[model samples]
Target: MAKKVLLRVYGMTCDDCVAHVKNGLEKIGKNVDVSLDGNAVLDIDNDFDPYKIPSLDVFNGRYKAQVKEIKDD
Candidate 1:
């Protein structure tokens, strides 16, 4: 079974910020699908947990993005 989720992120100030988050998620998910808005939706199969995945900032250790919300689809 696959899961879908919406992610609202803060610290995104422009298109590059959007791209940064999008790219980061894609890298983490590998084969999963990802799209970005003020938030992002991720569709995945398996035990991957969005909440457990470190924030973009945390992963990079630069504090560039913060997750604002996580919701099911």
Candidate 2:
């Protein structure tokens, strides 16, 4: 089973920011959903540590990502 992760992302102010976050997160998980309202959700493998998600530096350090919640899905 996969785990659902809710991330509180900061600095996402536009659609382009959402796209950048979604693309960056998709590299590490599945079903990536990013919003301009400062949130992201994805499905990751159970064995992976949700807290260890790397900083989303793909967009030139404009965004900060933190794990807000994690649960079974």
Candidate 3:
């Protein structure tokens, strides 16, 4: 099973931030679409735990992520 999730991201100030967010999210999902406007959408495995969504520490704590929605896909 697969799930489509909408994420609300914060602290993205530029394109570089978007890239970082996209790359980080790709580790957990596919079809990653990240925007500087503070949103991202992706398809994740059903077994993927939403509670484990990273704090995006790859960017040195510059970003935060929260699940806004999730649905069967």
Candidate 4:
């Protein structure tokens, strides 16, 4: 099983920040898409708990992440 999750990210101020977030998300799964507007939709594995989504620590403590929505796929 897989899950589609929407994430709300904060403290991203540029393309570099976006890249950092993208990299961090990639560490968890391959199907991750991030937008400039501080939003991301990820296709993650069933075992990948959305609640465990990392914070700014994944990006050198310069950002924050929260789950906005999640659904089974």
lDDT by residue (tens digit), candidate 3, 38-64: 989989898887656755455358788
Q: How does candidate 2 score on lDDT?
A: 0.83
TM-score of each: 0.59, 0.86, 0.88, 0.87
Candidate 1 lowest-lDDT run of ten: 58-67
Candidate 2 per-residue C-alpha lDDT over 1-73 given as tens digits, one digit per residue, 9 for 90 to 100: 4899999888888898888889888877899898888888999998988887755455458778888999998
Ranking by TM-score: 3, 4, 2, 1
Model 4 lDDT at residue 23: 86
lDDT of 1 at 45: 48
Model 1, stretches more than 4 Å misplaced? 30-37, 54-73
Q: What are the per-residue Cα lDDT tens digits for candidate 4 across 1-73?
A: 4888899988888998898898888887667899879999888888878788854357458788888999888
Which parts of model 4 have CA positions greater than 4 angstroms off? none
Alpha carbon lDDT of each predicted model? 0.54, 0.83, 0.83, 0.82
Q: Across residues 9-73, which tens digit of lDDT does each residue of candidate 1 receive?
A: 55555777666666777755544333334556666445776665555443464324334454444
Task: Give the Å shift of residue 26 in candidate 2.
Answer: 0.2
User: In model 3, what lDDT does residue 54 have?
Assistant: 52
